[model samples]
Target: MHLLLVGPPGAGKGTQAKRLAKKYSIPHVATGDIFREAIKNETPLGKKAKEYIDQGKLVPDEVTVGMVEERLSRDDCQKGIILDGFPRSVDQANALSDILQDLELALDAVVNIDVGDEEVINRLSGRRVCSECGASFHVEFNPPQDAGVCDECGGELYQRDDDNPETIKERLVVYSEQTSPLIEYYQERDLLLVIDGETTPEQVFERIEKELDALE
Candidate 1:
């Protein structure tokens, strides 16, 4: 099933995407991961993306579309792919539609894990990470055994600047401005699945599983 998962920063869409990909034997393709790999390897597309990244500018759609086109054509995607982050704007969504239409691949669904503004703020603001091992913990959900410390690596957990309330609020604003239309676009096509995102991560994944099962 070719799928798209859309949600706010703290929506846990990534975790659910991973689980759904594993269950359905599809590649979980995240734009950030793709960019990191491309930029680290310095591919032609990566070079283009890096010019924007180095200048603190967003990578243009042409460059991103090219890289994604290359990725989706791979043999593994014969099954399908779960897209985590891409098509932030309606223009990109149209571009994706063009690509998929040309490839003759149908999108199964577009899922939105919907959590409200205050809940999103609280969830993200309380997030902390282990810098050394990249382990994520929340003050509320899964606190480390030692307060502000990682039990496995003995590393101090620190809140990321991006997780700050002000920054996260700005991100949500940008997301709403850029992605709301895309959400509506898919909704009109009768492909949007809205899931309550305030639930536990396990429950969220279970909900995604049920949605995908119904689609099948």
Candidate 2:
């Protein structure tokens, strides 16, 4: 079940990634997680990544690709792995193809969860987080007992700066620009599986499972 999960921000991609990984008994190889691990362990590639991250710059493709290659080369990845958050651009996609070729493995599918820009804006902008416990809530979907307060810890609930409507809109624009061609790239290879993301999480996972089952 070697899969690449793709979605815009607030599309529930992370949730689906965990579900698929658990169902298939494969490691969920999220790039962010791997980067943190590498940096924590002070690996060479991690050090390079940290330098760029500390400077508030994107990690160069080579460093990102190197970290990904290292991760996929692990023994646990022998059977399969679910990849999330790598290959954000077509260039990285090509790099990934090369990495897979070297490893003698190929992606079974690239699952893309699709949601409209307005829905994404609504989903992200409405989110609030607990300042103390980092608990999450949505203004509409999962509000706390009291307005702007955390139910569990009695902490103040605040919307993150990045979760502001204007910032979310800007993020959507960037996501579209970066991901459109990457989506097309996978579609050309007949490995793209587009799933409706506006539905409930279970419903969305059902659709994704149906698609992957067909592939099997």
Best by TM-score: 1
CA shift of 151, model 2, Å: 6.2
lDDT of 1: 0.90
User: Candidate 2's error at 34, in angstroms?
Assistant: 1.4
Tens digits of per-residue lDDT, candidate 1, 1-216, equal: 999999888999888988888888889999998998899998999999999999999889999998887777788887899998888889889988988888888789999999998999999999999978888999998899999999779898999999999999999999999887887999999999999999998898888889889977
What's model 2's overall lDDT? 0.93
lDDT of each: 0.90, 0.93
Clashes of each: 0, 0
Q: Could you give candidate 2's per-residue lDDT for residues 77-153 as a string of tens digits? A: 98998998988999999999999999999999999999988999999999999999988899999899999999989
**Candidate 1 Cα misplacement greater than 4 A, ranges:** none
Give the least accurate 10-residue stretch of model 2, judged by summed lDDT.
172-181
